[model samples]
Target: MTFKEAAYFILKREKRPMTAREIVEIALKEKLIKTSSKSPDRDLAIQIYDDIRLNGENSPFVKVGRGLFGLREFYEQKREETVGEVQHLIRRLEETQYRSNSPSEFEEVLKEAFSFLGFETELKGEPGNTDVVLKAKIGRDESYTVNVDGKTSRSGKISDVQIDWLSLEDHREKTKANFIVVVGPDFSKGNVEKRAQKSGVVLLKVKDLIELLKEHARYPFNLLELKRLFETPGNADYVVEEIIRSHRDRTNFLENLKLIVEEMENLQSLLGYFSVDSLVARTELGPQMIKSVIDLLNSPLIKAVEEVSEGKYVLVIPKRELSKLFGRLASACEQEKEQKEQDDVKNKLVKNELTKDELIKYLSRTERVPTVLREILLPLCLKHGVVSREMIKEELVVRKMAQNLGQAGLVLSTVSKAIGENELLESIISYDKLKPWKKDNFRLKEEYKEMVHAVIEELKGKEQPKTDLKNRLVEYLSRTERVPTVLREILFPLCLKYDVVSREMVKKELVLRKMAKDLGQAGLVLSTVSAVIGRDELLGAIIMYDKPKPWKKDNFRLKEEYKGLVQEVIEELKEIKGNLQHGT
Candidate 1:
């Protein structure tokens, strides 16, 4: 490798500032290249150093001095460097560009990079004093504003304070969503940490930024996590414990993880959705205790939960899913508590099993994903078929109630009767211990069974695999079998109003699909209509399709209604495409 390439490799791997002599010694010990103190190649190394220090935009090597080189861009402008002078320069530059009526190469490159990151950005006004404003869409009603400061690197001098210095709170308020990343090689980890702590800001050093571009482009760098890591004097331990150690100690953690796996095997047969959470709650533990026991559900374990949803979660011996793993862990915990009373050896074994070090290592090495619990819920829809998001929410309430009861362990007659009544929210769940509503089949009132059946039949009919777009859609609409009532009310009308054309077609299609399914190896050709019409729209249309207040409804229906207004989105797309087609 060239000296520059060798330097980049060493620094990137070391991930710390190092002196030139230190780097040379290590490189020589490893026999990485043919070099000598007396050789002329030492002159070549000097030239390599100059190449990196200059032309930084084109160089992969960022020189942080004292012979250190990193692969990152390490410079950004200070905010106050140019209010009047810079503003004037910006205006003049803008005027020159307007006279030419063309974007300069630098402006084009900057614009492209910003656009790639989902920004609507503009270079307005002028040169040294010009402003770069970026508009970013956050969510429905939130848009973020970014102001890019313009400055250049200076060897040893820091920028001077200007018209106003931002107070810690003010700085935090102003740059809450924005970042003050030190984008050059010379930035120190200690400096980055100090600024971040004082302002509750996120500081991405040059090397980290380069690594981010290479690896986690889509994964938003958690500003909050970074702030916490940098702000608190010792919070770095959280990063080490939560991320680094979890990776380093994977082997030992995985062994304890096996305990959870065993628990799942034992619990899967006896549980449904209620097992995982119920087992956790049964320890009489609060959130902190649960977090402590699980080493705060490290990122790797979170990703593992996602694997279960994706069908890649390690399958245990027949009928034992990964959810059982949590159950098994809880069982281990319980078993440990019990054994503590009788077997000292067993107690020590448990103590040594899942130490903080091992847990951290395992989690760090594993994949990182979000909303693992939510992902786990997705698989349930496949098994239960008709559990709508609404029904899932309702089930959660019941599950939570069940968990509370399970934790109590004593079945007081009054509380037992309350549990029997089945009045609870769907979100209150521990899926493993979830009890089926025992009063009637499918939780449908007896009088609504016929209506439910009609809806199911309508859904079944739409399952035909016809090529006619309209017919296939109608078939899909009518064919959605095992649909919960909340979904049914929304879907049935949309099918009836938009696709069915007549009730006879619905009946014929429904019966035909059901009969086809009854025959061995038959499959209905159905597509997801709601895929085209979103969940929000489907939910909203259902209310218009039927009249009763939903069995279990949430006020978030307002959000759903807003989302369902995708029909209005047609215009926005049309406007853009039309403008593009006309070369506007």
Candidate 2:
């Protein structure tokens, strides 16, 4: 474990500041400060501590107050604290010797000490309060927002002087949240400890913070644990060291490391959607944006993966998360590959099977193929030219023949050829042209006559309805001059359910329903419904559908009397207006 790692572990586990002695104890217990056989009783842990403290100022580990060291820079940066201010405070702490006991009334010293630790200090926020808060991110794939009250204590509990506060429940509700740091020398009684235990919030004290700084110099925790130690600088070093040792089984560690790496890479890729560079470099993006990306990469939700390439990473994760992410990626790649193949086919068809003039003149007019299917073939068309088009047609015919053995291929020619015979021979000039014909006897029995006949009949009786309501409607429409609005309320739903309604049907229905006086008014009513209401009601009354519950909200059905009443009112109003105008 590095200094940052040690500091992180302390914060996460102990939830308090740690003393140099306490940190040394933890290091010995965990065997973090290694000793050679020749130097068995030489206090290797203290040596590590001294080294950390010597260069602790402005280093990864920083002294918070007297005898308390913490990974201040790590937490401060995690919480987006001012680097310069933190450096200044650390400098001040190095020079000024404050009492080892309780911090004094001299606010400047307190402010400087906070500054040294990189706390965003606000004086007299709403008055009568001196609150110090520590904020930082923790977690692999989650935003573990921790807040610590800045205070120190002999009881090894966080202080009640909350620099920031949020309920524990709120914190827990967060995708990954831990604590709200209450920064002080000590808490009222065991309030800090109780809350911390109950809410799973860390409590850091001044001394604990100091020791963390010391630990960070030798063996530092990752961003997450480092943040927690600073949040509540208690005797966190021991707790964190124990955690590291207990969990440092080689197999588990390697597995976790792999998982973290993979997750971090995935996170980086997600961030790349916004055009962010890798954590290792400054992209073209602004500094703040880059910082945010780095923050995201280091978040608990995103585990740090090993770098595979420049701006490329593999995630460090277990099989489950990896499986899901890989599955999605694999699916997307397959879809893209499939689409590419389809496009290649189409392009080949265009390039080989059709002449440039033919493609330009007639390809735009072709609409039988769906856009998705055309996309598939576009590349093929581009590649093989006219030959690919023939291939596409042959494939389609083959598929159809496969499905139905008796199926015959359609005359695969343009509209121009169907309408004008001379253009067909001219447009298609090749040795292949004579293959389908036998000179003057080229006129084969028209196979498409049945399809054409069906189309003609369909057009002739387009408005014919199987229901008797249609005939009665037509007769009533012939008698009526004006449409009654009441009929629309009923007809709209019917049109929607049975896709058999038309403009003539609407007019006829109005008369059949006794809602119109004459056919002219029915026509006018149909026109009014089509034009003013924008063809909504007369055509169909379909409730906009959504998944699972299409009819959840909308209820469009109109009662018969209510419809009649509304129409009657409109008629009465019109009559009244006409009479008043005449009288005037």
Candidate 3:
């Protein structure tokens, strides 16, 4: 294993923090890590430090002090104990002679305190500037620099005017340090505590620093934790505790979702079409908590809830319908295979004189031919009469078949042979220097079109009557209850008059002129229809052309299947209009 993996394994096994040197020593002795670096110990140390710096609290290693490390949980517990001990020392020193020192002596005492607390101290001697600069590691991932200004008073109270010129903000602007601390006898006048709060400046009592120095002298402590106590707002212990609580809450939420899914096959089925309030009450969950859980279960992949009405839902499983679909697909595959075998025999009989019917049969039997290609080739042959080999290649590339010219040529060569063998195309010109061979002028024979039309009618006889687009729209509107009653009355007549409706028509006629509410309710109604009946199916029912330029003044007309339903809605609207005129 590498140094990082080896160090993590050892730390996890020991259940304690180990310094880089100690970790390397143990890993080498136990044959845990394989490395050829001459300075393996230094390499390991650098790796551990980088991991801690990059991953922060998520890192397995936590810095205990300068050059000391431990497991994260152990470090957290030890940190609290150290901070509490320092707080006690601060209280003790507040009542001593430590507060009655001169300014220079006070600076010396603060310097000593920081030095003992694992900080590298530098005294900055200049007029109207910070007194001392202290650098310390905050955690495995963080290091910080702080500027300290010393203030002394024999009365045990330092006035705000003495330190007003040395605001944390100005000092930070000049020095670009992470934090600024003011070490003084005490800030007891001019609302110093409130000032400190507003400016984010750390206020340290002279006695507090002396006590911390004395405590460190007696017993080593984690200076990082002490730094956090001074820098972090509010109780640092509570902040750390909340971090742990949040992590636990996240883990529990995920586990709860997994357990709930296993216990309830369809959670919404318990109470069909219920609201968010009912879910919370039934599950005994926190009022704000059930929404996220319900949303997770309602995702499209899970399909846990079917929205039967707005703000109300029911559970449904599509397994039975899915099974039926699979069965139909399997039957279709068998039919395609049988049809292919029959076409092979038919092709053998008319190999030289291929009719349009035979060509359609060949196309229908061919698997994986892109729909766009079929649409392009069939129309061009029927209209243009003649098509060149080069033209075919160009069209194929334009349709994104192959990436470039060379690849398109390769694909076309393969497809050309298939077309020629089926007798749908005949070569008229031989290959030469100027151009490649060309195919004869082609058109779909009348007899062949008649034969295909007959087949379509036979299939239509076996098919069931499809659901009408207008009826689907009405069902969706009824369920959502989103459309205003007056607007609904206007929309029925508009759809009937046009036999279809576009977004522009709905916006101008129904929303702007009739409703006059300055709302985009028409778009919302169309979106609901799209969602309920699928965007593709709804467009297919209303759009006149297969390849529609919707942005180019296109007029959508109802398909033959849906025209009858449009007429029905139109009749209903006429009756309503008659009643209104008669004052019934």
TM-score of each: 0.21, 0.21, 0.26
Give the range of the ten consecutive residues with the poorest summed lDDT in model 3. 426-435
lDDT of 3 by residue, 405-476 (tens): 788667655655445554443221111111133232223332233233333333344333333445664543
Instruction: Summarize candidate 1's per-residue lDDT along 54-108 as a digit string, tens digits.
Output: 4534765544432334455332111121122234333433332221112232233
CA-lDDT, candidates in order: 0.36, 0.39, 0.54
Q: Give the C-alpha lDDT of model 1.
A: 0.36
Higher-ranked by TM-score: 2 or 3: 3
Q: In candidate 2, what are the lDDT values of residues 1-584, reduced to their tens digit?
A: 65345645764576554544466457658866554432121232233344443453344454343334456544442122233334444443332223222222212334444434334443321122333332333335643444332333344434444323344344334423344444344455565466565555555444444444444332434555445343443335466455355434422433343343443455656763222344324223344544443344446645433345554544444446756665565656655643564355335433332343343333222233221122223333334322323454455555442133222223333311342343422233211122233111111112222222222333335323312333443333233233333333445444344434455666776777766677888766655544433334421322121222431212223333123222333344455558888995
For candidate 1, give the lDDT of residue 395.
45
TM-score, predicted candidate 3 vs. hidden true structure: 0.26
What lDDT is reached at residue 40 by model 2? 23
Query: Which number leads on lDDT?
Result: 3
